[model samples]
Target: MKFSPLLAELINALTCLPGVGNKSAQRMAFHLLERNREGALSLSNVLHNAMEHITHCQRCRTFTEDEVCEICRHPEREASGLLCIVESPQDVLAIEQTLSYKGQYFVLMGHLSPIDGIGPDEIGLDKLESRLQEGRISEVILATNPTVEGEATAHYIAQLCANASVDASRIAHGVPVGGELEYIDGNTLTHAFSGRRKV
Candidate 1:
């Protein structure tokens, strides 16, 4: 009739994950406890290790163990002078898989949401502005999601680039409105990146 306190706590903890509701969390808890304790233990270890060691890359704000991410550290990528900006690290991986872009990336980690109290500084826009002011970036490609918040964030960054006299462009709508870059098809993402236009 009722779950044990420890099982209920496990289910509640699982619900902290995005998109995971009570039913799904219960299912996951049961699945792990009954079918695969070994896998669950491994996942727990990995999650704890990552949370302790991973941090935002100083330059791009992507997750990394070092001061800078591998992309920013790569000497060959620095000379390209092109920076593609996206909302999260997942978008970075998505664009990289397309192989249509050769430049480095700047991850916002999130888009602007005034109602949620997320602002420019909250999303690290000031750091991005400083990077632009360095005058090394020849072009900035906005690859944020097509959602309203993403668009607003892009426009804000575009203005920041304009103030610094750097070129700013937005990826094409081949991504579809309300779509996230991480879910877009590789071919479509390639087309969007190639067809980017000035904002």
Candidate 2:
């Protein structure tokens, strides 16, 4: 049976999310229509509100409603002497879940991928350079994933830090090869952060 045009569009949009295939989308559409139209409307409202209100933090670049994120604005968080670098805000959340790090963060928003023409400036490295020159950070922990692009990005940042005479280190071996920090367990991530070594 053919779905209505509106229903088809909604199902297609649902399938745009990662891991949601056409079949799943169709099932979701049917379930939402059959069981709870209000639930579907609520989901739509949340998505629209988040997209409209959430934005990158000024200091750390994590998504937030105001100029700075809760982490950057928090007086209790360690403000000086430590900076953890991660590819995305999600990675920051992943590390935070471990509760092992209390320092600041620098979110790159993306990894350096020469093949895809993504450069340091494109990933907010220039902004990071200015942050480093501010003289508040004592150490920079490169927490990029273990992928080829991730490693290359980390090495590039390390070189930059060395040239500027800033202390730099990479998260240690607890993270498996080809694994993303977002996927790593909290314990492993904590161990990696604690065991971080100079690069």
TM-score of each: 0.81, 0.82
lDDT of candidate 1? 0.93
Tens-digit lDDT track of model 2 for 1-199: 8788999998999988999999999999999999999998999999999999999898888788899887887765655578899999899989999999988888988899878889998898988998888887789999999778998999999988887788999877588879998989998898788887889
Clashing pairs in 1: none
lDDT of 1 by residue, 1-199 (tens): 6799999999999999999999999999999999999999999999999999999999999999999999999887899999999999999999999888899999999999999999999999999999999999999999999788998999999999999999999977677779999998987788788887789
lDDT of 2 at 73: 77
Candidate 2 TM-score over all chains jointly: 0.82
The list of candidate 1 runs beyond 4 A from truth reads 174-199
For lDDT, the strongest prediction is 1
Q: Provide the clashing-pair count of each candidate structure.
A: 0, 0
Give residue 4's lDDT in candidate 2 (0 to 100).
Answer: 85
